[model samples]
Target: MTLLKAKSILSKDFRIGRASDRLFGSFVEHMGSVVYNGIYEPDHEAADEDGFRKDVLELVRELKLSVVRYPGGNFSSGYNWEDGVGPKERRPVKLDLAWRQVEPNSFGLDEFMRWTGKVGADAIMTVNLGTRGIDEARNLLEYCNFPGGSQYSDLRRSHGVRDPYKIKTWCLGNELDGEWQIARKTADEYGRLACETAKAMKWVDPDIELVAVGSSARHMPTFPEWDRTVLMHTYEHVEQLSLHHYIGKRENDTPTFLAMPLEMEQQIKDVIATCDYVQSVKRSSKRMKLSFDEWNVWREPDVPYTPWQTGCPYDWVKFHMEDALVFGSALLSILRHADRIDIACQSLLVNTIPMILTNKGGAAWRNPTFYPFLHASRYGRGEVLRLETESPKYDTKLYTDVAKVDSVAVWNEEKGELTVFAVNRSEESIAYELDIRDFGNVSFAEHLVMNHERLDAVNTADNQGEVRPRAGGTTTLNGGRAESVLPPYSWNVVRFNVQSA
Candidate 1:
């Protein structure tokens, strides 16, 4: 009889307790339905008394989003804050060059703040470092943070918001390294502009936090140089050095593909080192952190950009299952380094590669990738525990000798629960023993699993329930340990309870 060798994982090492848990922070932008129908569909049946969709709000709360980046991805670079404020009736209609849509100006600045308040999440505002600069940024600070008698603050008062928005975290720009970015600037030009703009903004609201743009991607030809140049020039001017990284499933191979997340793990280390290097060069005591502003799974080959002649409003691309798995991997990486990355936005919150998407007006449903995002945000807080696991390597086109299962566990100290988030990207079903050694006096709780029949499965307006989360199977609890069954191509979160002995 042939004997099957168990996928043995020895739980023996205790490395660094945690890196960071900023995976809680996600992003939202005003492109496509993200603003129009994604969150603010006036025609939705589930909209609340304030015209905000109750279904979406409930979902966001369920996801337990900590921070939602607002206003723009590329859209902010060209946005006019004044145009969006004041009486809606008197608001001017303008062209949205970034998304190629008509900016009705009805749902601008104040409307977003109102929605943020409704969702019960902190706001991360990105300034227009691209088209507009210092003056507009200062006015925005006044409008959102300053007290009475000021022009912008008075405008905020006239608009019915008596209290200031006081959004503490702010981003300087979105993907300024890419030439495709609206009003793209050279590194030198951007550095000077950001320096000036940040100085002026700090003068307005000294307490506010600022993020300077980093490289769009390390793979870009002008990478480390762009990052160094920008940081060298703007690090002292801001609190956080922004880093934007995205991963996509271009290759059909799952093994190497799942390794993308760990690649990002290395990415953050490099970014931290970069921040330190620049800080050392300046001999500055102020330690700058990272704001991973924009990140997600975007493969240009998968979703071919619609020609502008077709009037494709702002690169609107829906997400897929494999893409979501890659996203899951990305979250694990971010959680692993939460210490240096205090503030991070998930690029966008809706429709355009959005974590949550809505269709049929106000009726929202979870995307296949949404479950990983939901689980990570919901359970991934407190000090992250460095879990030790061993999975056989799978060779693929993108990465060599990548582990089949990618997982990260977060221990919510307050709740006394150890949440293990695992992803099995192997082609065959496998089970692994989860050894909770040394630390005992606990029991297994609920295990939530999200898996679909096909890798390409997705949710749509007509059939939103096609790729949702469901139970995988019963979990096994042993002496201070548990055994988990990981189905092929699945993402699962297991909850464990450990009481004081």
Candidate 2:
């Protein structure tokens, strides 16, 4: 194997932008066991007075999630928010056509908001524009944000929430470009509805922000066009555009899978260009940012599961050690584009391709992909510093000019700390060096690395500690230069604290 070498230089003065706290967000949809047995299980031994799972809530807090998008992915397209508001005993068990599961309607608007409070995270509500329209969107906004003296606000009072939830961000719809969605529409169709709905929603609560739907994926036939058209119509009405993409692998191409971040980077760049072009065409003063509402590693089984049933448990995606590496790379991609993409959510939070997996009535465990997210959320706050990198390059079957090492640096000025998140994508162990500028009396804080002997090794509920991050030894800062050996296919976080020289 050829020796791989990589070097990166970062400075506190050269920064991308102040990282948005909302960038560390996750999603929760009413699909699979994500709702019923995942987060809220009254019968579970770990349940609290409010029936929310204490175990899951603790893990969620540990992840340091800033915001959570609620109620649906595809489920929102067909969801009737009204059906879920009343008492649980009276609430009917409705069939969720999106996932073919039965939504008990037991956990509705109030319950989710309550859970958000318990987890200490804000909410980003997504409205139904597929089966519903502007009227319903306006009503939901009024019910959630309006204080009193109105019918919807009074209805919220009747539902036991005297204070309004005051949700700030709202999604017009989810994945209108995909055929899998209910009442899917063309770009023009979704644009018109989204524009009209956004206007009416702002008419109800002008202070709130809106996210218009973009393409479901870059591979979609109408990706750039969809983004262009949607922005052309709703650019002046909305504050952000929504994008969703899930990385998956087949036939065991580990190198290709690890390099998937390149693809994500391209997609983000294309969308940014499209947004800018639209701004120039309309001569609009406002610039559109992105909300990556759904993203994760989804691997399909050799044989697809047959016979989907209501309330039946399903394990959609079980992540391995390699997936964590890719997950780290994905976060780095988002950090690189932190200037424009302000918000992101890592798909489902519980079961069915979740960061944390639960054992129904038993225990909850963090998957391999959880640690990278944890480290990013904890140390990756503050301003993102730009890095000048010199790394070995290679080519994969699908991706060319691939960097053997990928990395991002975040400088927390308030805490006087700097964090460098790096990934060694090459098959051979590489010597990595980082040079710091304009800093004084810096000391190496911690070097945390996530690596496994087997790339596909996983942690189960019984053996939850099997695949976890461990200390990757220590580093010494000599004149602001730190060096370490990045193991082959490893995710490393090197942290340093600054002091007076």
Candidate 3:
């Protein structure tokens, strides 16, 4: 066993930035059963009038998600938004080229907006820049945001939506640099398209913010170069650059997998450097932020992804307890970089290795990774406080000087609360000490820890509570200092209620 010692200091002066609720966003794609059987199941007994599963909606609401990116991941690149609007009865059934799943135009623009409203989350629409271009994007923007005068707006009225959806964020495209994407474009091609599309869409609705596509993954041969070239064309037109990363487990190494968030941190840094490089070249004052719109722990497909299968969808994998630790670490990494990363979406919200998983006509249960996100979305709000930790280090196969503890602090002034989220990456328990500075008297409100005897422990529909967070009582606060024994490979959240601080 390894003896790990660590200390954390929190001060209000050392703050990163205010946390955007958008950072707590999640994705809803048309792939697999994420749509048909995941969030929406018309015939499911628990479904609402809009065909959305009420139980799933309850969980989504519980997550307190701020923004939901609608209509696609890769699916958006090949999607036709017009097909899913108007009357569901007359809606045409087509094939989704990206996911190879049957596209039953039943749930489209109007349905998604309604669902988003019901869940109290903002909607971020993605335009198809792959198969379609600026014209289609502008038309869709007009349809969704215009107020009943133009052709597209009037068409929206004819579809029974009198008021504009007034969506504020739009994604110009998705993963244009990846060869697997339909009509994948070169950096120059995508950047030009994104720039023009953003200009036209803003012309229709100036209130909106646009995100230009960055490299699909950090390892893409063109990674930081792809970001730089895209930013060269879209620097002024877009507000954020979109990034997608799916951390996978290979070689069955827990320590290496736990250190994956380090890679994500480096990816964000590389993208930031690329963005600044373009800003320097253009001599522009504008600085680009990031939208990590698709992120989660997923494995590469066991089988080659088959195309053109109308009814077939991507396979779903059950995330184990170890996956939850990694997911929590990733969220911690995003929070630590809160200044630059304003928007992040956990890839597919349900049914496809997501936070929530459901069986057709059976049950929708929270996966092992769900609780960590739930805690973050609920308590991980307000300003991000820079936390410095001194701890024993270990080297992984991929990452060196890996700290035994990865943590972040959030100070919610209105709530008079300071929440500390920490993950123990070591194989032995860490007796951690926490010290507070530049703050008034506070009391330890609660300590919640999620740990299991076996890192491979998993939760199923019937055994959904198998791996969940429970109250941790060992942490004690004396004066302004606190001490606790962080369990081996655990995600721990310690909250302090400020008393007139």
Q: Which candidate is the best by lDDT?
A: 3
Question: After superposition, which runs of candidate 1 have C-alpha atoms over 4 Å from their true positions?
Answer: 1-22, 299-318, 360-362, 472-474
- In candidate 1, the residue pairs with backbone N, CA or C atoms under 3 Å apart (3 or more residues apart, or in different chains) clash, namely 19-339, 20-337, 20-338, 20-339, 21-338, 26-346, 27-346, 28-349
Candidate 1 residues 1-501, lDDT tens each?
321112433232443344344446667666666776667766678877666788888877877767788787788888888898888899998887776777677688888888888878888888898888888889889999988898889989988999898888888887787877888988898988888888999899889888888888877777767778888888877988877787776557666666777667777888888888988999999888888877777754323344322222344455667777788878877776766877767766766677677663435777666778777777777666666677776765656767777777776657777777877777666676677755567688888877777877877767887877776555787886677887777777888886756
Q: Indicate the TM-score of model 2.
A: 0.97
TM-score of each candidate structure, all chains considered together: 0.91, 0.97, 0.97
Model 3 C-alpha RMSD to native? 1.8
The sequence of per-residue lDDT tens digits that candidate 3 reaches over residues 179-279 is: 99999999999988888888888888898999999999998999888888899899999999999888888778999999888889899888888888888
TM-score of 3: 0.97
| Alpha-carbon runs more than 4 Å astray in model 3 | 1-3, 300-313
Better of 1 and 2 by lDDT: 2
- State the lDDT of candidate 2 residue by residue for 16-36, as single tens digits: 987889889999888777877
RMSD after CA superposition, every candidate? 3.0, 1.6, 1.8
